[model samples]
Target: MRFFALWNPFVFVGYDIASKQQIKETVRELYSSKPHLTATIGFSFAGLSAALSGAVWTGAVATLIVLACMMFRVWMEHHFRARSSEDVGEKWVRLFVFGSLLSGFGWGLSGALLLYGTSAETQAITMGIACAILQGAAGRAYMTPGTALINISLVIGQMSIGAFAEGNYIYVPAFLLYFTFLASFIQQMVDNRLRQLNAEQTAERLFREITEKNELLRIANERLATKAYEDPLTGLANRRKFDLALAESLAASNDTGSTISLMMIDVDHFKAFNDTYGHQSGDECLQLIARAIGSSLAGRDSLVARYGGEEFVVIVRGEAPDMAIAIAERICLAVRLTSLDSLPSAPPRQTISIGLVSSRAGTPETREAMLAAADAALYKAKKGGRNRVCVHRGPCPGQQQEQDTVVPFDAAKQA
Candidate 1:
């Protein structure tokens, strides 16, 4: 008897925890598919079980009390659902108090009945079942300091009844000791699991936030790299990218016995046009030339760039002076066709003068040397007259003289 009293609280606490876990899982599964039907069946089963158990062992009074408690629980569930907007903690607290009150009253009445007329075994069975069912359903409510007081009151009432009938007051202290240790163990386990679940949820949320931030940083880096290496106005490779490409093309030319050709293009009288029309119209003219030049070069080894101001550069691989000259002529013709009426000047249109230079593999000239030679030819074109293509013919009198007389184009005025 002493052993039974000592261990009963622990056993009851373990059963209560297991039962609550099962009920939570079951409710989740049922709610996912058939919430209304599942809840209705669950309440009906609980009410029926409590009623039958009470009637079989105790009496009509115990059965009535169990039925009334079940009905009150159903009503409280409805109230909670209706006030779904209320704070969940507050709602559960209210439900817990309500459940404890019902349990205390039911047990108190049973204890009295046992002390006056019923047997010890019957009283214990009825009280245990009633406590187990009520605790399983209302465990969330007892998440407060008040639960300890309620539980103490219950243990005292049960012990007093058992002691009064048997004349062995030792049962009172024995049951209290057993119940305290058992309830403490069960509460610790439940609390540990809840803490673990909370930690897992927090970790998942933090991981998702970190992933989103990394993706945003990746996109931002891509945009920065593109802006750094690309020309914003003409949507072409900028001068920096052009310089890198020229170096690579020169290296490849040396390795593969390929020739590299460079073309330097200057929009004819661009400054006069910009002054005549406005900065906006000048920008439109530059955009039109960029489009025409880009359209003229369609090979993988050819690249066009907004070299500087109104000047553009084209690099072509595996092409000789004649082929490079032909491509320059094609671009010149294409620009002539692109109507520049947006320019303040009317009709007979705007044109570009191009200078072409070709360097065969193993040539003594570097990429910068080739570009200087092309610029010299471009100067000769401007000197002779604008709007024509000039091919560099290696250190000729005209090419050297122009290289000496070359003047830098005014970037701001070139528009």
Candidate 2:
């Protein structure tokens, strides 16, 4: 019962029913195999052998028929092979069916012409060759089972005509029984092939889905990381990331005996500005100042971040005190140049006070000390009438003035 079920002609195994695409793809597979080519070459060789054995006319004619069938098969392959499975139409499939039947007819004629009315040994050889061709047809049944059936039946039926004419009563029932077995075998081959194709397609679909999901997961992680360390309004590094960077820089400066500068920048009179021009304008003003400060330090290797409300910080590595002061001066100038036309009843311009602190080689350093010194310098800058750069290191050598380290804003620019 199990054996019958496995090879049952009416039983279509695998998925509920094959999709149209799968059926078309199976039809396309028909063009992928070239069993007929091998059959053509083998018959040609056998024809030549027969001619050498003194059956000249029979051998020559058989060779011609085999060559013609080979040409038909080649033409069918060339015509349809370039078309994709999606492009395969019903008419194209019917044309292929016709070609298979014609080729089978040619092979049957060639076999009958060569082996009919021969000795018992020759008759047995003919039957053996016919059975081999039938098996080849069965193997390809998965590609186009209906076409295979037509080709197999036509080939055997044509050859059987000669066997019946020769009064070979024994060969008839033997051929019929063999045909039934082959029919069952062809059905089983088709079921197995369909199952295999389904498995491959399912695996491919799963691979694609997994790849897409992984890409989406990677993008989500990137977004989460950005929100964790980025200031939303100003697009600068937030205080959390700023503290981490400042600590790392201070540690490297202490270890390598190098210098690093810290600048604490505060928007001057921001509370008064917010009172005069609503909080909406205040936020816009801060955003503009942030961009101006970023532009001032564009060419320098520094990390500019939002320290807190109305204040920002910058970290510059490997710079001397003078260079650090100059950078602070640039920030003062850049913020003073920010346009205020957008704010209602806005002042002529906006300004920011920057405090510069540099930790040189041999200085006992810590992030806390650096932050405190920078904050003290910023307080002095704001108290010294604002819009200036003040250094925490008191006075320069040979300077007599109390505010020697303070870079006062250019009064000439106010004119």
Off by over 4 Å in 2: 1-102, 173-177, 180-206, 247-260, 271-281, 317-323, 339-341, 344-350, 359-369, 393-415
Candidate 2, 279-328: lDDT as tens digits: 88889888999998899888887999999999999999888878887778
Q: After superposition, how far is residue 310 of candidate 2 from its true place, in Å?
A: 2.1
Per-candidate TM vs. native? 0.53, 0.70
Could you tell me the TM-score of candidate 1?
0.53
Q: What TM-score does structure 2 among the candidates reach?
A: 0.70
lDDT (tens digit, per residue) of candidate 1 on 1-415: 1222322221222222333554344322311212223323333343344345453443555445545555565665566556645344434544545564565565455444433344455545544543453343233322332343354456356546755665756656765665565456445545555565556657878998999999999999998987888888899889998999899988888787788898899999989877777788888788888999999887637989889999999999888767777777888888878887655555346788887778744554577677887888898777767777777765433333333333222212222
- Extract clashing residue pairs from model 1: 6-178, 10-182
Task: Give candidate 2's error at residue 408 in angstroms.
Answer: 6.4
Q: Residue 202 in model 1: shift from native, Å?
A: 2.4
List the lowest-lDDT window of 10 residues for candidate 1: 6-15
